[model samples]
Target: MSTNAYRGALLGIVAALLLANPAYVGLVMDEPRERSPTGYTATAITPTNASDQRTVVNRVGEEEVLTVAQLEDANEYSPYGPRYRAPERAAESLRAAVESGTARTTGEGVTFTLRRVGANYRYLRTHADDSDAARYHRFDVVRTNGSTVVTTTRVNRSTVAQYLVYKDARLYTALPEYQRETVDEVIAADEYGYRPYNDEFHEVTESVVVKNGTYYVFTTGVHVDDFGPSTKTVVSLLLAALGTLALVTSIGFTLRATRERRDG
Candidate 1:
């Protein structure tokens, strides 16, 4: 074979291998898979009158209210306190609650009113902790009936809230301020797990939200793969670029050789 022919063949082989890098990477790559929690379900309590004012009454008589600083100090020494096993964000939330005087009970026999806090919309599988293994959150809805106030709390899989949370986390930085606010408003208004939009990327096997006067519905089902670009992807892209260059060079050599043969 002529020198040009040999060079062209070598280049062609290199091009083919490089061009196939992406396919190879796709096959062997370990993509981050996120499946809906097992046994996803929800439970609800009977509705009460909306007019019934709910207060954080300590059921176990009066107890000493500990400050957030004190709790942290205690955790530093004991490390097995109530906040020890809690996620950092959850612990922070507890601290905030204590500081605000909303939650001030500790020790045995302590009981306090339960209120549904805002949802954590930026929840990601990568950010999951041991607590995520069996996650749940509550939502309360109140209605007024004549001179009575009715309220009900519904408990559902955190996966339900995570759908929107994932979206918000993914798009928060990219969206405009007004758009961000719009998203926040939507989340705030639909606190009872309503409007579980069908995400195109994630496969939502099951999703439903039932909230009305008589009954409340809870839905859960979604799988989110971590889409962040991996090292394999970056390498594949680089290989693709090299492959294109090699292929083009091979074509150039083949064309030159053909011209030489024709001239001879």
Candidate 2:
């Protein structure tokens, strides 16, 4: 009935609500500036008619969202195309990959959209000791393909030559120099294994642009380094632990105060 009691009750309710949903407290940190320019760029890849595979000419702001297939056709039968995959990487890491100076890009005009290029190991298992047994390659993709590449790492550490059981070869790719370094490191990871790593990463790309009537979006996410939505999960958990501690401390102090007032 007292004003103090009412105030305590109100504080308790407010704290409960905040602890329940982090978004309510604006606990979800958004990094619009940190997002990749190329992420979520393809806004209109919907097939215009269900009867045909044809896509509609939908505009996402100033840019037109065309599928990789459509762009390839416009240029030629270029093997390089767009793809959509899970998880996103940081621009810094992307830059590092390119800086390693191993990536090479090769494709005639249209098919030349290999955002990533790397090697595959067919006989990697037999030659586990040899990181240079897999054949190096790079992919060139073009419009509307909706391509997504996932790079993973394993603690066990193996090479493409080991996983695919390919004959003697080394890790390599064709892209901007640094980009190739990224591919080489990932393909050389121990955890990336039989399954793709892209499925588990969080996306943080800010914007995507197709300049000169065509563009390429390249990205790679590394474990314990760059995380996506899953990273949010980790944050949420840590906050919850703090919330629990707060609740306990608040209750303990409240009870102590009550006892001292009664004794006085």
TM-scores of the candidates are 0.30, 0.23
**Candidate 1 residue-wise lDDT, 130-215, digit = tens:** 23332223222122242111122222333333332223223234544543443343334432322223232122212112233222
User: What overall lDDT, based on C-alpha atoms, would model 2 receive against the true structure?
Assistant: 0.31
Model 1 segments beyond 4 Å from truth?
Answer: 32-228
RMSD (Cα, Å) of candidate 2? 21.7
Give me the runs in candidate 2 sitting further than 4 Å from their true place. Answer: 1-14, 22-229
Give a tens-digit lDDT track for model 2, residues 1-264.
Answer: 444444455556655654675674345564333322211112211122221111111111112121222322333443574232210222222222234522222223212233322121111011212233312222222234343232222212222212221221122332344434333343344432111223321121111222233222213332233446555566667767766765665565566557666876
Query: Using TM-score as the measure, which candidate wins?
Result: 1
